[model samples]
Target: MKKLGLILSFAAALLFIACKTNPFTGKQTLALVSNSQIFPMSFQQYNQFLSENKVVKGTAEADMVKRVGQRIAIAAEKYLNANGYQGYLEGYQWDYNLVQDDQVNAWCMPGGKIVVYTGLLPVAQTEAGIAAVMGHEVAHALANHGQQRMSAGMLQQIGAVAGNVIIDDPRTLNAFNQAYGIGTTVGVMLPFSRGHETEADQIGLYLMAIAGYNPDEAANLWLRMKANSGGQEPPEFLSTHPATDSRIANIRKMAPAAKAEAAKFGVTSFK
Candidate 1:
């Protein structure tokens, strides 16, 4: 009983103190690790990653990556300032790089370090396409998805430990692990990850539009991604990202609203 009470108390403390408000959603989010704590580690990892990989420099594609990233960064700051998140980006040192790799991936780290893998360019195909994807990646950083994921993981482990302590028998503890492992992963963690992906998509669309990239092209980029994947994705419930068709549909639905948002900022034209 004492162990369980202690665990509950600790969890309550975590809930109370480890929450940060997301300026975009106007909702509190898991942030047990602050950006001040996460950023230096992220920067170090980013530098190590760049050192290990072939960071393509000075090429047109590389230049486009930096160009799109800078535009998206400015758009993010403008949107945040307009939305009353003044000084939100004070410590963010924005850096962008294109890495030579065959994996179709790009990501933004905490504090605005970004990398675009070469394998993604063929699929991106145009500046608008790059903006669409870059906006999505940047949205991940701005939204603090990495911090949330890490926090959720910590909670999941804590839950497992609490569950183990509550059951004394060896066989019962074994069964608890068996049941809790799959339940927590599928029920809590997977859904949380998927939710972040969807939110990033929506936020990215608006960011791209605000940066003068046609939001309509966001859907078009996903259509190309779907083709590249050849429709062999896991079920939406099992995947961290929505299935391709669903993602494309969601982007299509959000594009008009995204453009409307851009109009508020006097961005009536797109690149």
Candidate 2:
């Protein structure tokens, strides 16, 4: 009971004190781990990854990756400033790199380190398509999804610890472990990840539009992505992303609104 009490108190304290406001949504999100701690680690890991990988440089495709990433970063700043959240990105050291990898993936780590795999470029097809993909990845960083995920992971660990402390019977504890693992992952973690993906999709559309890329192309990009997958995907609830069809439909529906938001920034034309 005493150990359980301590665990509960620690978690409650984290819940109360470890939160940061999401600039785009104005919602308080988990931040049990601060950016000051996460950024340096992420930066180090990014540098290490670059050293081990074949980083593409001096090519038009590499140039386009850097170009689109810079525009999206600028768009993020513009939105933040216009919304009275000036200096929200103070610690971010934005870096974008193209890597010679065959995997179709792109990601932005905490503090704005971005990498676009070569395999993604063929699917991206155009500058706007790259913008769409980069915009979404950047949104994940902007919204501090990494920080939130770490915090949630810590909470899950705490839950497991608490269970171990409270349950003494071996067989009963085994059952508890199984149930807790499945319950927390499928019920909580998966949905949490999907929600982050959806939020990134919305925020990315707005940022791409403000960067003078056609928001409509985001949906088209996803269509290409879907085709590239040969139509094989896990069920939506079991996956970290929305179903491709659902994502395409959502992007199509949000494009008009994204364009309207971009108009506020004098970006009336999109390429």
Candidate 3:
């Protein structure tokens, strides 16, 4: 009982104090770790990764990546400022790089370090397409998805430990552990990850539109991605990402609204 009380109390304290407001969604999000701690580490790892990888430079494709990233960053700042959250990106040292890798992947670290793989270029195909991809990546950073993931993971681990402490019987404890793993993973963690993906997609669509890239291109880019995948994907519930068709459909549905929002910023034309 004492151990359980301590665990619950700790969790309650975290729930109260270890949260930050998401600027985009205006929702309280777990922030067990602060960006002040996450950023320097992310920046260091980014520099290390760049040192070991072939970072493309002085190329048209590389330039396009940087250009699109800058536009997305600016769009994010504009949105935050207009929503009365100015200076939210003060410590963000935005950097974008194209790496010579054949993986169709891109990511943005906590403090705006971004990488786009060369393999993604074929799928992207145009500046608007790149904007679609970069905008999504940048949204991940702007929304602090990484921090949320880490904080949720910490809570998951704490739950597991609390279970171990409270369950005395060996066989029953073992069963509890197995059931807890599957239940938490499928019912909680996977859904949480999928939600982040969807949120990033929506935020990216608006950012791309505001940056003068056709929000409709986001849907088009996903169509190409779907083709590139050749229909090989796990069940949507079992996967970390939304199914391709569903994602494309969602983007299509959101495109018009994204464009309307962009119009508020005097972005009447899209590339």
TM-scores across all candidates?
0.98, 0.98, 0.98
Q: Model 1 off-target regions past 4 Å?
A: none
Q: Which 10 residues in a row give candidate 1 its minimum summed lDDT? A: 235-244
Candidate 1: tens digits of C-alpha lDDT, residues 73-113: 99999999999999999789899999999988899999999
Per-residue lDDT of 215 in model 2: 97
Question: Which residue pairs in candidate 2 have backbone atoms (N, alpha carbon, C) closer than 3 angstroms, thus clashing?
Answer: none
Please, what are the lDDT tens digits per residue for candidate 3 over residues 129-227?
A: 999998998888989999999999999999999999999999999999999999999999999999999999999998999999999999999989988
Expressed as tens digits, the lDDT of each residue in 74-140 for candidate 2 is 9999999999999989899999999999999999999999999999999999999999999999999
Candidate 2 regions with alpha-carbon error over 4 angstroms: none
Top candidate when judged by lDDT against the true structure: 2
> CA lDDT of 248 in candidate 2?
93
The lDDT, on a scale of 0 to 1, for candidate 2 is: 0.96
What TM value does model 3 have? Answer: 0.98
Please give the lDDT score for candidate 1. Answer: 0.92
